[model samples]
Target: MTPAIITKDLTKKFGDFTAVNGINFEAARGEIFGFLGPNGSGKTTTIRMMLGLLPPTAGEIQALGISVKGNQAELQQRVGYMSQRFSLYNDLTVQQNLQFYGAAYGLNKVDLKNRIQDALAMAGLEGRENAKTKDLSGGWRQRLALSTAILHRPELIFLDEPTAGVDPISRRAFWDLLYQLVADGVTVFVTTHYMDEAEHCHDLAFIQRGNIIARGSPARIKETMMDGQVLEISTSDAIKTVKVLRAAQKAGKIPLKEVELYGSLVHVVAPNIEKKINDIQAILKKAEIRTEQMAVIEASLEDVFIASMK
Candidate 1:
């Protein structure tokens, strides 16, 4: 089957500045594809071009087996979009918002009614239909917005940082809904900056400064992009541990790839670091920083992401 989305050498520019520069990739049918990047990394610009909202300066795009340029009217009916900003009216009730979007999608009265119920149940907003959209919690409002976007049963959906400000529990709940959609044969193209969320995607493209630095599944990226082994250290003070390790690396006391603080722990990356464990211990011991624990551990996606950026 043809991929759900295809872009070849896609490029977008605003005057002399290039927002998305010659990026290329494909999102497969019925799979979640994550576009991972930091802020100002051209993720939104690329999505707009794929949706035909912004014309690309170069290259071609095909969505759902159809060209996006001249067939926008037909494509709009087959795809859904939930933007970074809220798209629903604050003053409208939950049911009212769904009704409005359904009508905009040209759903007939009979089909609209059934689809509305399905949407309400899917969003867990059946009894809250009469509540004002502004009165809902951030999580509830996000779910409602997602429900509205999918009311017309589009085959493909584009979500732009859908879980940005929501709490962790709510973000997990929202991802559950996305999993359900994929199981029902919907293609999800989501962009997010969260590394943990990127792990949930079937495949991913890591973008930085309008360039794709790496592309693969979480496991593949970690295996291929990570430059060396990771040494996890638990010390009395994480900040002090990082400072000492970095100083040691700069002074030629030990060879290390990267030293960063991870929560309360310190992670040091280097090649064949196991052979230098004693040297690391001796340095920390001299610094009077107690080494509670230290071991070589597997590299995480966040580790690979940070290394790739450097």
Candidate 2:
């Protein structure tokens, strides 16, 4: 069976600069594919190429079993898209907004109304269908954006940082909607900078400087990038310990990224964690520092991304 989305060496260039530099990627049917990257990593450009909104300078993109370049109209009909910072008519009621977009997509009045209801319910905005868009909060607006994007029941959805700047609750709700879509066999391809949000994806493609640096299930990706163990140090001297280690290691160009402070604990990412563990003990002994606890643990997805990006 054809992948829901496929792009081989897909590229985009602007005069002397290349935005998306020969990136290859694929998304499985009914799967959630995340494009994780920082700002200006050419994620948006790649998405545009995949959606056929912009022509690629090189390579090809196939979506829903059709070449993006040759079958853009049909592809668009089968795919839903929600862009970052998208604007809907501020004055339009939710129902009116849905109806207008539904008609534009050529949905018959009856089907359009039913889909509108379904989208609203999926977005948790059923009762607010008559509310003005501007009256909604940031979270509600995001839900509305999602509702509008999937109003036509497209086979796949492309979201560009859909949860950026939203509250955690809103982000969670959005993921719930994504899960529902997956259950219904609709694929999700999304790009986001938020690591916490990226963790929610089933699988992720890490993009760096327009290239895919890593692609796998989040857990697998995390494990692949880390060889040594992560030590979690919890004590009254967490900050003091971090300061001592960082200062001591900075001169040697230690691989330690930073002393990530987690509540009352300090997570130390290092090579030969057992050696580091012994070293930490020696330093704390010398510094007369006391810790409530210390243990080695697995690295997180954030650790993997940081290591890969570096």
Candidate 3:
């Protein structure tokens, strides 16, 4: 089957600066494809080019098997986009917003009525249709935005950091809705900074400095990108531990590849971490920091991302 989205050397430049530099990837049909990266990593630039909102300086993009160059209007009708801001008319009632969007998409009166109801149900706002959009919680607003974006039943949807500020629970719920869409054959292309969210995608690409550094299934990225094993160290002071370890590494005291603080734990990455565990413990002991536990653990997406960045 043809991929839902494809790009080759997709690049964007703003005069002297390059926002997206020679990126290439594909999103399969009916799958959640994640564009993972830090802020200012050109993820949004790539999305805008794919959506035909911004013209690329060079390279090509084919979305849903249609060239994105001059066929923007035609493509717009078949694709949905939920921007980072969760575009909605806050002053309008829930139903009113849906009605407006449905009409904007050129839905007929009867189709608009039916799709509004479906969107309301999908957003879990059945009884809150008359409620002003501003009165809804962030989670509710997010769902409402998604509902409006897909009111036309488009074949593909582009979501730019859809869960950025929402709480974890709400983010999970939003992803549940994404899964439901995929189950119904809709393709999802999303960009996110959350490592956990990246794990949920069927495939992902990590972008940095306007370039794609890694792209693959989560498992594949972990297996292929990680050059070292991760060793999780439980300590009373994670922040201090990270500082100390980083200092030691900078001074060539330890051969660790990466040292980062994860909540109350410190993760140290290195090739064959088991052999260096004793040295790690000795270093912490010298600093009067007690090591509660240490074990080799599976590398997380964040770990792989950091390693890839290096």
> Top lDDT: which candidate number?
1
Q: Would you estimate the TM-scores of all the predictions?
A: 0.98, 0.92, 0.98
lDDT of all predictions: 0.94, 0.83, 0.92
Residue-level lDDT of model 3, residues 124-204, one tens digit each, is 789999999999999999999999999999999999999988999999999999999999999999999899999999999
**Lowest lDDT block of 10, candidate 1:** 301-310
Error of 3 at 255 (Å): 0.4
How much lDDT does candidate 2 score?
0.83
lDDT of 2 by residue, 210-298 (tens): 88889888888887777566788887677788787777678663456556666677888877877667667766777778867888877
Of candidates 2 and 1, the better by TM-score: 1
For model 2, the run of ten residues with the poorest summed lDDT: 253-262
Mark the 10 consecutive residues where model 3 has the least summed lDDT: 116-125
Give the alpha carbon lDDT tens digit for every residue of 28-103 in model 1. Answer: 9999999988899999999899899999999899999999999999999999999989699999999999999999
Runs in model 2 deviating more than 4 A are 237-240, 253-264, 284-289
Residue 183 Cα positional deviation in candidate 3, in Å, after optimal superposition: 0.3
**Predictions ranked by TM-score, top down?**
3, 1, 2
